[model samples]
Structures are given as C-alpha cells and as structure tokens.
Target: MSTELTSREVCQHLRDAALGVRPLQVIGTGTGQVSVDIEGWRLQLEFDGKHLHHCGHCCCPDGREWALDSRQRFGTDPVSLLSTWELAQIEGLLRRAE
Candidate 1:
C-alpha cells in the first residue's frame, strides 16, 4: 500500500526542491490575503479584489527593488508552473485530505 502524503510533507518537499535551485518563488492565495513564498522567503499582500497593498515584506535582497518588479509580472497562481514531481506530491496531499 502507498503511504499518503500530507500538505506539510508536500510543502517540505517543495521547500527542499527550492533549495536546490538558485532562486525560488511561490505565489498563492490565502483566506482573504495573497502571499508569496519564495523558497523560504515570504512576502504578504492584502487585496480588496481590486487593489493590492503590500505588507512591507519583500524577499528580494537589498538594493534589488527591480527584482520585485520582475516578480510582479508573474501574477498570482499557486502551483501554476510546478514540476511533475511537485504536482504529484501536491495531488497526493489533496487526496489524503479528502
């Protein structure tokens, strides 16, 4: 029998994979907020479904505000461009949740 994976496990796996890559960026929507989890870095944004308000937490290193500009173009969509392994792990977590 195959063991089911939990969301925490999935997240941890993703985190580990992110560590392998030079830079990582994650975008997801929260309950009433939107968050960006780049590797282990985190940034939160509040939106009223029209305008967005940043929470002053940006993952880009100092003297690199341009990076934020680059990230902005990516838009918001969790798991939009995940790898096959990542998608499988997340699907496993979702299945376990059901």
Candidate 2:
C-alpha cells in the first residue's frame, strides 16, 4: 500500500538524504527544485521562496506521477495540500529567488 507522509516527514527524509544519513539515499537540487528517491517512491518538489510550487511523485522511476500544489488556492484542489513551514521546520532550507 502507498503511504501518505506529512511535510515534516518529507523535509526530514530529504534532509537525511542530503546529509548521507541513510544507506540508500539519492538526492539532487537545482534552481527551484529538489529530487529524492526512496525505497518505493520518487519525489520531486519545486518551490518559490518558502512556498511550495509543485510536487510530483511516483512509485517507480519511469512510472506515472501525480501533480499537486500547496501554495495556490484554485478550483479542485487536492485535500490537505497546504503544508506549513512551522510543521516542516525547513525555514532555512528554502530560500527566496534572487
């Protein structure tokens, strides 16, 4: 079964990967995006400043993925998309575009 994770869990998992705190860890970061690979998931997230822009995830590297946004409020928003920084503890990890 697929698992649903909190923002804090996402942030911590990424942090651990970046710090090489785990045996199986792969991570990459670019201008406004970060990619991570977990045992059964691949996650890519984009951010504008401290706000999330987009999120993509799939069970397999070459499989289908889903898109979701946590920063904008429009029609047909996914449930529980807004993830607060307070809960994530990633204030310093995310930065504004220069």
Backbone clashes, each candidate: 0, 0
Model 1 TM-score?
Answer: 0.26
Per-residue accuracy of model 1 over 1-98 as CA lDDT, tens digit each = 42432223333434454444433333666654555554444545444344333233334333222122334433223233455565454334333322
Model 2 Cα displacement at 41 (Å)? 0.7
Best by lDDT: 2
Best by TM-score: 2
RMSD each, Å: 13.5, 7.0
Candidate 1 lDDT (Cα, 0 to 1): 0.40
**TM-score, model 2 to reference:** 0.40
Cα lDDT listed for each candidate: 0.40, 0.46
